[model samples]
Target: MEKDWPSGFPGINWLGRQEEEAVADVVRKGALFRYYGPQSPTHVDQLEEYARTFYDVDHALAVNSGTGALFTAMSALGVGPGTEVIVPALLWVATVTAVIQNNAIPVLCEVDRSFNMDPEDLEKKITPRTKLIAVVHMAGTPCDMDAIMRIANKHNIPVLEDCAQCNGGSFRKRKVGTFGKVGMYSLQINKNVTAGEGGLLVTNDEKLYTRLVAAHDLGVPWKKGLPDETGEVCFWGQGRRMGELAGAVANIQLRKLSHVIAHMKASKQRIKDMLGHMEGVSFRRLNDPDGDTGPFLILMFDKESHAGGVAQHLTNGGIDNVFHLSNYGLHIYHNIRSLVEKVPLSPAGNPWSLSQNSDSLFEYGKGTCPTSDDLFERSVIVTIPSRLTDEQELEMTQAIKNAIVANVTS
Candidate 1:
């Protein structure tokens, strides 16, 4: 039964002729670069246009990858040595790495039971130097944006929503990315929608949009199909433009996103219903269940040993990508060696040692976020593949039940 279970590559599972056709069109037209080529390139431009409508934002920018979007956004937001950026403990290493890359200190905010940023801890983490709040919508669930935005507004700080995992998710009735000043999404192969590798950024700020455009390209916004060096937003750019090849696929994939999310959400709901309730077994508390994108299901246990046992049992049963949250690799802060050790970017021993960052002293380790550390130790994360047949779902449900019975109930 386990052999029949699908691996959790969400968008890859749904790829077909549509993606192939889009790619073929780019090759046929001989327009590999997004800006210019033998034929006029429009795929990346079209993807951004469609993204604006889909995410309901005024501006959208396509980039090379999700990490590029983060770096570009942080740069446009004026993150530097003197500033601090608040981030949830349960985020991809790229989230925190963006802060460090920008020469800003990342203040770790504890995550509540939602497994997303804790709004209460977020407020406490804010300081006079706090320049941004990077809210990560993790594991297919939207964060508490209402509470997070209120805190950010009170402090007059900007929020950058990282929707890499929860691409189609919303909080309350609003989309996750719209709540922040700038929001970014990943189009990596494992994401809800794939371009194989691409990223999208959305924002309502016109002035900031110009900066984003410049920062993502050659440090100058494009004017009349050429770089406008005279623009006020000029600076050093990261050359993170999305190629036409990726844009072609991403354009079609963006259109299919809602359908992909709908299928995964329904499948997850059905599996959760089948599991029902069990003693000493619980699910992660969603801030808004209606808005969940549903790529992963998290089960909580009373003790770390129980979580470890269940994860091992499920893996032994041939379940793919099951893990005790503590062992979830770079997604957990303590596991990020570069961040935990304050590894400097250069021999200057800067960022941490610079005069501008001297006041923003902090430590990172297992004890830094005790609450999140506890949650990590006692939770089991299971990947919910994008497409699952009735039989596969049944097998998964039964396998989960058996694992819990063997580990928790005993």
Candidate 2:
């Protein structure tokens, strides 16, 4: 029989009176949208300010969703039809969709044990057509940015760091998002800090910052009605601004970020100490192990079959969240139908089969990245709750140990 889990295993209360008052104040004033006019409320500005200060960047642009940030960043970087962008194969499908939305071809790259883009493969995928290299900081662990940056500089290719899953994570004392030319973070419900559904894009370039603001706000130049306006500031754009209420809540959440990260790091370290010595079970390798944000605890097995059996044992023990990612729900990368066929971006199917990508060698299928395929097949992931206690961490660690012993001992 399975051991009973802790009360907070599934989830625990995270939001409190702070978020309550923020939303209440926004609703009371009826200022539900972010705008730059003098009469506009300061909620969005405050949120952006907090992000800028936290990330230590010159600018931060808030948008409707993480995917929106990616799309807007792509647009700001001048990615359009025929542009080739290199991306990691092991990432949420939204990353690929962002490239397609910009009418660019996504050149998928292989990932190392860190579950981030392998620099060697990234370099090999680059060609004259390559315009940008988008990297995901998978599972709250930073990629080998030093190597990635060297290759990017050598090729003169810009890089966009997707910090959606790894906000506040760092490498060698440097934060994950700030390593690239542009970095994007998600404020979705499940993220480290959330505003229901919002995104933040950070960059040090002032010109790119201006373009990002216009790109997400329908190209209405800042201070359009002011006397400083020069020829009405025209630029192509897509309306994807984050709502004011999300901004308000996210601002408050930002205050709690440091405290939350501290707790998560402690909990993750406790779990690691408990389970690190287990035979035949190992955690995912990180270039900087101390930098992991502890969003999820992943275990790699000796064999794919062993991983599958352990997952089954966990599920049989009433732990339904244990996932063998090879066939896991929503995380599957193999044989994705969307990548195999042309994506529907517009009514006319403009981007996928457009003449611009006619000569591009875009390929996606089972064997696209053999390393990623092998890694996912042998991996079993258990999501670490945002709030966890020592007792709960031990229970989770023991549960995994029990499952492995019961299923993989033979």
Candidate 3:
């Protein structure tokens, strides 16, 4: 018999009142468009205002997707042809997408135990063409800010944090997005704050804020009170505005994020501590976590030299929550277009390659990022995360140990 885990859905709230009225509210009034005017009841404007305040940023632009925020920000920042944006190969596809979307080259860099950018690798990758660095805090883990910032300052490269997976997470007491020049958030259904489908960009620089706002709002400052005529507008932009409904849901969810994050941290630590005791398997330790308590725990299976088992063992031991591909669960990368571009060597030296990348920073195949590749092959990519209770955590611990004892070979 299969064990029924209550949280099969990505972001189902058993005790959320804010989201309780979410569905009904959208269905009743149904003001879908965000640009209705001063009287407009759409929550998108309110959401943007609320996000700006909550995130402590000068401005927050809401958009259709978190990737959209990255794309829009890159465009406004002038990251296009001939520009190089540093990125992590181990991160989500969107991080690279933002760089390529702007027609900029993406120089793949390595990650430290914190799962953030490696400042050493970053230093080596920067060049005259380098314009930006899009760093993702893997699994809501904060990156080494002091190092990343120092490097960015040294090279004058603007950091665009792909914080889609880390909404309420922080770095050295400051919020993740605020640490960089601009930060992007995802409100996709599976994220901490779910609005079905949406994203937000945060910034403190007034000039960048103005540019992004104008670009996001049809090339004008056409928020709630602007006329639909050229007489009131001064420029042109594509319509990437998010509806009020998304903003409404995000507002209420934002309030509960801290509590949820706290719970997740507690839960993640429990797993980490338990897994750390295993002989062949160990949790990746880094300085950024303050030694413990983050949104999730990352355990790795040591290489063939040592005895270890990957997350596949979790399935045999009756535990099933890992992320090899998808952000939510056991999903894989399945973009069909990538097949045609297969190359034999990545600039970093991965033997497998793409025929043609959006930019040159991406190589054919040099078989680089071996650590990520090895871990990807043998890891479990656990996703039980910060939501499970102590009892549930214990059960998972037992299952993992049992799986490892039976599976790890000499």
Q: Which candidate number maximizes lDDT?
A: 1
Query: Whose lDDT is higher: candidate 1's or candidate 3's?
Result: 1
Which one wins by lDDT: 1 or 2?
1
lDDT, candidates in the order shown: 0.93, 0.80, 0.65
Q: Which sections of candidate 2 miss by over 4 Å?
A: 1-13, 36-41, 224-233, 329-332
Model 3, 94-212: lDDT tens digits are 76656655555667676665556677888988887788888877766777878899999888889888777778877777777887889998888767666778899999997887778
Task: Give one digit per residue, the lDDT tens place, for model 1 in 74-148.
Answer: 999999999999999999999999999999999999999999999999999999999999999999999999899
- The list of candidate 1 runs beyond 4 A from truth reads 2-4
Q: What is the C-alpha RMSD of each candidate to the true structure, in Å?
A: 1.0, 2.7, 5.1
Tens digits of per-residue lDDT for model 2 on 194-267? 88788999999888888888788777556542322352446777888888888888888877776767777787
Runs with alpha carbons beyond 4 Å of true place in candidate 3: 1-4, 8-10, 37-41, 227-236, 290-295, 304-308, 323-366, 374-378
Model 1 poorest 10 in a row by lDDT: 1-10
- Per-model TM-score on C-alpha atoms: 0.98, 0.93, 0.84
Clashes of each: 0, 0, 28
